[model samples]
Target: MNNEISDDNSDMIISDSDSNSEESIEDLNWIQTFLEKPGNQIFVEIHMQYLTDRFNLVGLNKYCSEKMSTMLKLMTDDIDFLRGEYSSMSSIEKRMLDKECAKLYGLIHARYILTYQGQYDMMTLYSENIFGKCPRSACTGTPLLPMGLYDVPEQDSFKLYCPCCEDVYRPAHITQGLELFSGFNGSVLSEYKRYQQAFDYPVEKHLTLRDSELPLGKNLDSEGDDLNIINQVLKFNPNIDGAYFGTTFPHFFLMQYPNVVSGEEKPKQRFIPAIYNFDLHYNSQILRYQELKRQQLEEKLSKEYDPKLIKTKSKKIFTSKTKMYT
Candidate 1:
C-alpha cells in the first residue's frame, strides 16, 4: 500500500510537470518568436499588460486602424487554447497581427518609457550598456541612452546618445534601434535633447517669403503684379545654365479656378498613390500609337473636298451602247 501511494504521487507530479510545460509553450506561441528571447521577456510582459488594459490606450483605432478587431482578439488571448490557436493561424495573418502588435506596443512603449517604473527597468538595461557604448575613445565603454532624432514615431529609429560625449552613436545591437525613445526635438523641455543640442543652441531659421510680393495674377486695377514674381525668381536664381528665365511662371489651368487657392500648393493625400515619378513608358507608347492613328484619320478627313458636284451621267448614252451590243 505504501509503494502504491508513492508511485501515485510520482505519477501526479510528472503529469503536472508535463501540463506546465505545455502551458509555457502555448504562452510563448502568443507572443512573436523574436520577442520570446530571455532578454526581451520583461518588455514582452509590459507590452501585453498594456495591451490587456484598453484604458492605457487612446485612439485605439489609430495604430492598427482597420485591423483593430483582429489585433484586439489576437492580443487579448489569455487562455491556453486561445494562445495555442496562434500557431495554427495562417502565416500571412500571423505576420499581419505581429506587425500591428509591434506598432501598438511601440506607441504605448513611447509613453511607457516616460513612466518611473518603465524608466527604472530601462535604467537597469542602461547600466549594463545593453543599448551600446559611445564609440569615442574619450569615454571608453560609456553606456549610451536611447534617444530618438524625432519624437514622432516611425519617422526614425532610436539612436544611442552618449551623455559623456553628447553625440549620437550607433547602437551595439540592432534590436536596440527598436527601443522606445523620445527626442528633444518635440520641445526644448522634452526629457531628452537632440545630439547637436548640447554643442550649439539651436537658432530658428524660418524664411518669411514676402507674401505681399508673390501674388498669383495681375490685379484687376493694374498689370502691376505680373512683373513682381518674375523679378523675384530672377533675383533668387540669377545664374541659369540652360534656359533663359521666362517672365511667366508655369501656371496650371487649376490655378485660374476660383475654387483653387493658387497661393497654397495643394498637398498630396497620404493614402493616394502618386504615379508622378512612375515609369509609364509602356503606357506612353500605347497612347502614342493611338494618337498617330487619330492624326492620320484627321488628315484623311481634312484632305477630302466637301460636296464637289459629282454629276452622275445616269441619263448616259447607254442606249447607243446597248443598241451597238444588240
Candidate 2:
C-alpha cells in the first residue's frame, strides 16, 4: 500500500527513505517552490489544455493582464519571457503575475467544469472516490461527492457527501485531503472562493477549526443539553439503517415527533436550517442550469423550436368544401 493514499490525508506515512536526485535544494528554486505549493499545482499540465482560448476567460481580464499572458506562455511552454525580462518589472509585479496565473486557471476551471467533457472527467474522479469515502462506520466506504452546503462560496465550505448514507462528511480531514485531491482544494472549491488558509503549508501559520467552521453534519453541543445530547448525529442518524428519506422536508422527522418541543419525552437531536440544499439544488442551481440549456437550445433553433409561436386560424370555408363534395 505504498502508493495507496489513506483517508487520513496521507500524512500517516511516518517515514520515507527516498533521496532527492538533485542535491542542491537551491537549484530550480522558483520551479521547486511553485511545485511545492498548491496554488498553481491544481492547474498542472492537465490544465494547460485549457489555455488555448483566452476568450473562454471573458470576465477575468481585470485580475492581472500581464500575469495572464505569462500564464498562457507558461502553459504553452514558453519560459523565454522569464529569462528575457531582465530588468523591466519589479519583484512585486512578478509575484502578482504568479498569483494571477493561478487565478486565471481557476476562472477557466469554472467554465471548464460546465463543458460536456469536464463533467465527464469530474464524474470519473467522483467515481474513483478521489474525494474520499464516507466517514461513518455504517457507510463502509461509500464514495463521496464534493458538495457545498451553500452555493454562495464563502457562506459555507465544501463537504463530502455519500448518497448511500444520505450524509455529509468533512472533506478529507480538511487540508491535505483537499489539495491532494480537490485540484488545489480540488475542482469544487475553485474560482467561486479563495482557498482557505488551512491549505497553507510549510509557510502560512496553522488555523484552528472553529465551532461555526465545523464540517457539516457536526455541531458543538454540550453533553448535558437535551436536544444535542440525545444522540449527536446531525444528518440522517448513523444508528438507523433507513434514516434518510430524502432532502425534502428535512425537519419532517423531528417536526412530526410527539413532545419534541415540550412535555415528558426528550427530543431527537436534529436541527433544520432556514434554507438547505434541497431548496438550492432543485429551486436554484439545477433548475438554473436546465433553464440556461433551454434558452441556449431555443436561441439556436430560433422560432421553429416554439410551437406556441404558430397561430391557428379558423376555417370559414370548411362547410363550403363539404357542400361542394355533396
Candidate 3:
C-alpha cells in the first residue's frame, strides 16, 4: 500500500508538470499569434478612419479655391477643340482631348504637392497677390486678419512697432495705407515678423481702399470672360476631356444617370464619388496617425505594466489547475 501511494504521488506530480507546460506553451502561442496577425498587429485601420473623418473636403476646397479655379481654366482651354459637335470634331480633336486629360492628371499631382506643402509653409504665395497685405497695426489685441483689413483704434496705433528692424514707427495714417516698403519686397522674413506682431497686442495701421478704387467691376468682368470662354468650349464639344466633363458640364448631365443602368452606362453621382475618394484618402491618413498613437500607447503600457502582475495571474491559472487535479 505504501509503494502504491508513492507511485500515485509521482504520477500526479508528472501530470501537473505536463499540464503547466502545456498551458504555458498555449499562452505563448496565443500571444505570438496576436502579435503576428497583420490587422491585429497594430491600430492602423483605426488611425486611418480617424484621419479620413477628420479631414474635411469642404475645407480643402475652400483652401484651394483659387488653385482649383486656375486648374479648371487651364483644363478648359486645353480641351477647347473637343467642345463642339462630335461630328464636327476631327482626329485632332480626339488627340487634343487625350493630351488635355493627361495634362490635368499632371496638374492634379503637382497641385496636391503644392497644396500640401503650402499648408506646412503657412505663407501662401497666391494669397499674397490675391488678398494683399495685412496692415502693421490693424488690430492691436486681436487675431491677425490676413484676408481682410482691421480697424485700428487710435490708442492702440501708437504702440505699433516692427519686430524685425525694431522700428518704433507709429501706425501710418488710415489714408496713407501700410505701404509695402519699396525695398522690403514682401519677403518671408517680413511677413513672419508682421504675423508675429499681429498675434501680440501690438498696435496696427489701418488702411482702406476707396470705394472707387476697389476694381470690383474689373474683377467681375474677368470672371465673366472666363465663364463665357468655358461656355463656348462646352458648346462646341460637350464631353469635358473625359474627366467628369469639366467642372461646369455636370449640371447638364444630371439626367443621363437615370436608373436605366444595365451596363457601365451609369452616370456618375454628382459629388459622392469624389467625396468618397477624398474620405478614403483622408481616412487612410488618419489611420496612420492612429497607428502611430497606438504604438506609442503599447510601448507605454509595456513599460508601465508590472511583470509581477502577469506572473501572479499565470500562477493563479496554474495553481487552480493543480488543486483540481490533486
Best by lDDT: 1
Model 1 Cα lDDT, one tens digit per residue, 91-203:
66555555565556555655565555655566565544445556666564555555554433333433455555456743323232112222112432221223114212121
The regions of model 1 sitting more than 4 angstroms off are: 1-25, 29-34, 37-44, 47-49, 80-89, 172-326
Candidate 2 local lDDT, 1-326, one digit each (tens): 33222324221111111111122322323333433332222211224456577667675666446646666654344546544661256656554555455445444554565555655555555444444566665554555545444322113334545555567665435222332323332232231123233323332111111233467766444322422221121111111101011122212322333222232222222222237434544456665666688678758676645565432212335666788999
Per-model lDDT = 0.40, 0.39, 0.28
Candidate 2: misplaced stretches above 4 Å?
Answer: 1-49, 62-67, 86-91, 147-157, 165-168, 172-326
Supply the global lDDT for candidate 1. 0.40
Q: Which ten residues in a row have the lowest lDDT in candidate 3?
A: 146-155
Expressed as tens digits, the lDDT of each residue in 1-326 for candidate 3 is 21121322221111111111223321322122211221111101111122233232123333232344333433333233223332254556433433333333322322232233422222232123211222444222211111101111111111122222222332221111123222344543354355335332111110111122346654222443432322211121111111111221111122232231222332222222236346566666776676688679867887658798778878999999999999
The model with the greater TM-score, 1 or 2, is 1
User: How do all the candidates rank in terms of TM-score, highest first?
Assistant: 1, 2, 3
Angstrom error of the Cα, residue 50, model 3: value is 22
Number of clashing pairs, model 1?
0
The deviation in Å at residue 144 for candidate 1 is 0.6
Give the Å shift of residue 313 in candidate 1. Answer: 99
Give the 10-residue window scoring lowest on summed lDDT in candidate 2: 236-245
Point out where model 3 deviates above 4 Å. 1-76, 80-115, 120-122, 126-178, 181-326
